[model samples]
Target: MNKTLLGSIYLALASSIWGGMYVVVKIVVSVIPPLELVWMRYLVAMVSLLVVSFITRQKWRIHKRDLLIIIAIGIIGNTISIVAQETGTMLSSAQMGAIITSSTPAFMVIFARLILQERLTLKKGFSICLATIGVLLIVGADQVDLSSKLGGISLLVAALTWALMSVLVKRVPSEYSQIMVTTYSILVALIVLTPFVLPRLQAINISQLSHPAIWGGLLYLGIVSTAGGFLLWNRGLQMLNASSGGLFFFFQPVVGTLLGWLILGENIGLTFWTGSIFILIGVILVIKEKK
Candidate 1:
């Protein structure tokens, strides 16, 4: 298969898993605080990915010069991004969180052009506009008032952190395998989160462990959404440029919105359809542009 096609497939799979993550997180958050859940999810992801790395014999070494950069990626990209996302979800409705998080791709494009010195194309410019419109429609202009100031700000931070992670991942040395980068990133995130883990642990209800839903959600989040999704996303990034890879995020909101409706029985009204069309059109234009 073509590399682009493969990248698209990987991104699609990642997006679908991410879309369902909102619902899973909602269920888990009822039983566990967001901070504790975030730590546990990363811990589970770290262990699972480490096992895979060991079995696959993926190289674990990094160049001395690149060590700092990798560490920064781990802290800023993985740790901060996850924390921001979880905090944002806790502050807002799942659908609202998903919609706000969808802005990450647009922010990625902007950052790539400014930081990576990548040239922008008309298609990408168009995509930014369309995605903005879609977000507005998805959230409904009138419902904007529903957002608390702190929640809106938190979600914005989540979008920025997510975008930063995408940019930082692009800077990973070519010599390091994507799997290696992902594994180490998660490990670093686990370490960074250790300080907060104990406090959250105190709040944990041991009785909840017996509840299948809690365990199921944690397993799904750890194994599928965090580990599997990140691996696929990193693979897609390796195959595609930052801008192109970022464009794939456009599909996330659409997938997430549909899942929200189908699985959660959320309303799907005219605004969703209208805004989604604009976002889709914009994403197509962005992908068609040449690097």
Candidate 2:
């Protein structure tokens, strides 16, 4: 099988996991504050990845010049971007948030074209448009009001930061192990989040930690979503051009809708299915693109 094909699969898998992750995060955040939850997520993810690194006998050393780059990536991609996203969602409706996040692929495509000299093929352009429309339909964007300017702008920042991070991942030296990079980047994020999460952590009692649901959610967010998901996503980005890799992010909303239907008893209307078909077709078009 082609490496690019395999990379696309990895990206799709990671995005699908994240689609369900939003659902889990919603439930978890009901019991934990968003910033604190993210902090714990980074902490757990860093440790888990470190364990994996040790088990795999991966080198922990990194080039000095790359240190600042990884730190910047951590701040932009994980900490600040996540904070902005949470703030935007808090101030806006879910529909609006989804619609805004759907633009990330477009930002990534643009960035890859400008920075990496990636070609913006006609087929890729059409696929992005089709996917964006599908997302808007699925998210019921017609109902969203742009009146919440702060929320809208925050989401825009989040989207741009995420796109920048995706491109930056491609800039990492190919000789470096992606898992090591992931672990280090997450550690950097955790360090930056420590002060913010500490005050919140002090309020939690040991009894709260004993709750199975709390522990379960944390583990899922940290181990599965953060550790496993980032590893796969970075690996995929390493394998493919940032523009092509960005298209797989479209899988998030599709899987989210399906999970809602299955787990939350959410209605799956005709429009929803139709939009899903469009998204899938768009994804397929990108996946089939040859290097």
Best by lDDT: 2
What tens-digit string does per-residue lDDT give for candidate 2 at 1-291?
889788988999999888877777766766677788788888888889878888999987788988887888899898888777766766676667778888899999988988899999998989888888888778787778788888888888888898999998988888789898888788778888887788778776657766887889889999999999998999999888898788888888888888888988988788888888888888888778888
Model 1's alpha-carbon lDDT is 0.78
TM-scores, one per candidate = 0.92, 0.93
RMSD of each: 1.9, 1.8
Per-residue alpha-carbon lDDT of model 1 for 173-287, expressed as tens digits?
A: 7789877888788778878888878866877788986699999999999999999999998888777767667767766667777887887798889988998888777756654
Off by over 4 Å in 2: 145-151
